[model samples]
Target: MPVTDITTDAENLTMTLVADVAAPVDRLWRAFTQPAQLERFWGPPGWPATFTRFDFTPGGRAQYAMSSPQGEKSRGTWEFIAIDEGRSFEVLDAFADENGEPMEQFPAMRMLFSFETTENGSRLTNVTYFTSAEGLEQVIAMGAIEGSRLAMGQLDAVVQDLRAYAQGQGTRVELLDDTHVRITRFIDGPRELVWRAHHETELLKKWMLGPDGWTMTVAEPATDVGGTFRYAWEQEGAPETAFGFEGELLQLDAPRREVTTERMSGVEGPGTVNDLQLYEEDGATLLTLLIEYPDKETRDTVLATGMADGMEDSYARLEAEVLSK
Candidate 1:
């Protein structure tokens, strides 16, 4: 729990959050400035954030969305108002619609983020100023304070050394809820190349084969939102051992993030929504896939089939065959 205090001033129409982080001031600053790092902790727990556009300069803007386990998305925007290099910054924050435009029904606020060194590590001061007391009350009623605390509680993981934290860890899966699972793998490659490996048919065909005996037969990838992608695999020397998945692309942000609806080739009804994100730091990329299944039974059935091990095998091949060279 990094947060020390969360206070509200009704008269001033402001809310302040103070936290002590066990990281250097510079490291703390980097976590806030970098979109990848910020995304890791910007949303509370099961509702993870994805930043599609981030411009870290005065007069610039950022657009992001927090997705709930049930596939509900709450969008937000930030307009950079001022900056003091690595020490502090200010922005106008507001709720946004699906198109990234601010929603007039929700209250907008001015936020100031200040960083300073402390004896143990660093201190972060986040103050949000609302236009009116009712505006502040409205946000508070929406669970802003508790949500912010839970969100900041995750900052410690972001500030630590990425390689030290995840390099040796194989494909790891964590059940976020009954229907959502988050899978992560650290790839020893830059973000762009990793993204290319996922999007390019030639590159994907070389390494996406799950196990040694399997081979990719189809690799038609979706090129735009609403477009569908198909992939199939067959066992070597065994044509009958064929399986595939097809999905429609929902969102795309090159070299960073994409969301798709995945389903087995023949099976229909409803399928999982796969949200893939790539974040790079110090020449290494962390790939995260958040999969939303229709029910717990479906999630369990998929995981019970040794999915993590299969993913690990594919990721290892990806590094050895495509990224290493």
Candidate 2:
């Protein structure tokens, strides 16, 4: 286990766990902040976690559930209280219901995670503060210490696997559920630049072109909530083969996340909801797009269009044509 020490103080009503990770602070931070990576080891060996929602900014909330082999589920919620980017963060952790609301019978705890460079690599100091000594004892009696140790023990494999989440892996797609799909691409650029490339007309025109023979004709982009945008692309010298998309921004959190409704230009009825999130670590950014379709048919139909391959082409162009320059 990576956890070197586990201690409790009844007088202060706190429990502290110190772990030494064999990776840089930035890598460790990414493993925790990114939902794709966090889910791998958030729970103990048999119980695996799935994060339904992860908003890493202050005042935001994360909801997750750990499922056991016996089909029992333990739900939890994290209300982000404070964040010092790359260094530390604090959250109100509580046992939650199926809907992710905190349960009245369980007491909430304030947990602080601090990261720092160490001789071997980095150190993680996790401190849980309870309202009373009884609360602390209650958590310990529930096997909190053992569960945490086993969970952290699995961290070594995750952080060392650079090939999984690093740049140059191209676009990856995962079917999250019947109506949800997630796509991820690691960009060799900062978060701000990546976000700007998707919004600024000039930058978008340069790299948003999917294939070598295509050109972007319309590059209108929406950077504000409720604003509409349109984009069209055509093969070189073939205007008749042109296609376009139109969308209205639903939410915008600059340099972090955005949500929009997307559909083919002039199409009516339902459309897909796209949630785009960006996280930067060690000068590189991970761009995650979570798409929610109207149904499984629409989701599968879209994937069958070679969308993942096209996204990879565009992302490669983004690094070479926009970020490199």
Candidate 3:
């Protein structure tokens, strides 16, 4: 059900195609604007496209060519007219020569692209308008309708991958210093909810426990400046191996930044300093955690505890159980 509807009006000299895609407006818009992504889906099933230029702005230009299996190449160009960031845009599309020069005899048309949010996801609309009915008939007779439908159908899977990568389905770990590890990820939730998940006892308990078989029994989060915070979790039916973190709040700013001094549940050495920063991007939260260890050995110990996997699991649970609500 990629291409939901295709309406062709010979009298009005217009053809509109619609697709209900399972992606956010921003993500789908990027796929439509970015050169690397447009190359993946701008052509039909057998013919793959190669984008040579992509300037998604007013008075900009996008040039690409589709190469068929038998070494045949078809070039095209789009002269952008208007753009509304992540919402909509208008362009004049036409056939082009190998050097991206527009061909005079080809059917040149103005096309409007819109990405609108819907109950299920985003609804994408592509409307092509010609100056005269005869011009519309010329393109329609060339199988433009079926070709456009096939081209748009390839967008679903690429959009899904882009969505997942943005939501921390991939790893993003960087080392700032010898004794520090920084992890950044985009959580599929609002900034306020993600901030609350880190400070509220009940909300923290829903996702902070390492894996599925463990539970956080005691979570006392002192969210005020200079307050002491404590948390505890243990494997089910094995209370002897409980573990968590106790820390003191160094700074407090709701839904934005927080700094704390934390010690592992029962480590024999020094504690770590954690600086958590949250930023809102297009209605989602970007979380950055800076963990500082007193020594390189301590940092290595923390990383060896499967820290990345556990953190990813917790964030996944937070998205599904807390934020999605």
Candidate 4:
């Protein structure tokens, strides 16, 4: 019960997820069959989904769009193949285009979800069977396992939250994101402490690294508007590597925010401006960073290369630094 079990058959390319809810079979079935109820927790944590057409009968189709917490949206459709009231349901699932048309690149798969009543409550199991090994492999390669786990975890939380709300608990984090991630966290520390962690050479050594086996050789920051800042890292027993940025400090509000317009070398063709804003909040500080690229292709490439995770990790490190000090 409570998503306490999951099994995957790599050979058969099938995944089975089981969850137990304290609600009765009828109530659970309603949560599954009702479009409004389904939309409340159909997506991974942080994503708010909306269903367009949900006609539960066999041969009917259900179309929906899930909007990520960060604003990216994806569409999908499910054609109901079989439905046994309060027992089981099967569907053909596939991705849909922005205009709600099914996409050719995404293959349709069969999904069966079953609801069984028990003395404790209800057991819900979802079985996904792919059409071909290639299809299964493609889904697996796209991190489906982790995504499913995240979604299921969210579902569990949603169930508990719903139960609590029914018994009179207040609001909760109803929205979630499945893609297009950006990390914006507030740190509970002094502004000077936060600034020192980011600008100090000793702390920079603990974070920014050029490459494997490389070490930071230079980190110099001038505390003025027309000041200069340089950072260079080199590997042991190898030629030195460096990246330089020269710019004018457009604005420096001290202990609060700083803005700089600089021409960065070795990263595109120069004339790149990075805007970094810092503000005091909740007895600490909040930092927002926006790096403007010359073109959309570069931005897309950066996202594909795991920029979200990297930035999140960097912020986590920043948080640790602030706490440690």
- Tens digit of per-residue lDDT, candidate 1, span 63-165: 9999864467989999999999989999999999999999999877999999999999999999999999889989999999889987897787688887987
Q: Which prediction has more favorable TM-score, 2 or 3? A: 2
TM-score of 1: 0.76
RMSD of each: 4.4, 10.3, 16.8, 13.6
lDDT of each: 0.91, 0.86, 0.80, 0.64
Residue lDDT tens for model 3, 147-264: 8887787676467753454664444666655776767777877898898898888898888876789999899998678799889989999998887789888766577667788997
Weakest 10 consecutive residues of candidate 3 by summed lDDT: 162-171
Candidate 1 residue pairs in backbone clash: none
Model 2 — TM-score against the truth?
Answer: 0.59
Cα-lDDT of candidate 1: 0.91
Estimate the lDDT of model 3: 0.80
The TM-scores, one per candidate, come to: 0.76, 0.59, 0.50, 0.51
Candidate 2, residues 1-325, lDDT tens digits: the string is 5889999999999999999988999989998888988876798754567899999999999999986533468999999999999999999999999899999899999999999999999989999999998899899999998899878876875687543445566788877568878687888889999999999999999999887899999999996777999999999999998999998887665877677889998778788888787767678887878788899999999999999988899999999999999
Q: How displaced is residue 18 in candidate 1, in Å? A: 5.2
Give lDDT: candidate 1, residue 320: 97
Candidate 2 residue-wise lDDT at 3: 89
Model 2 Cα displacement at 50 (Å)?
Answer: 17
Residue pairs in clash, model 3:
none
Clashes of 3: 0
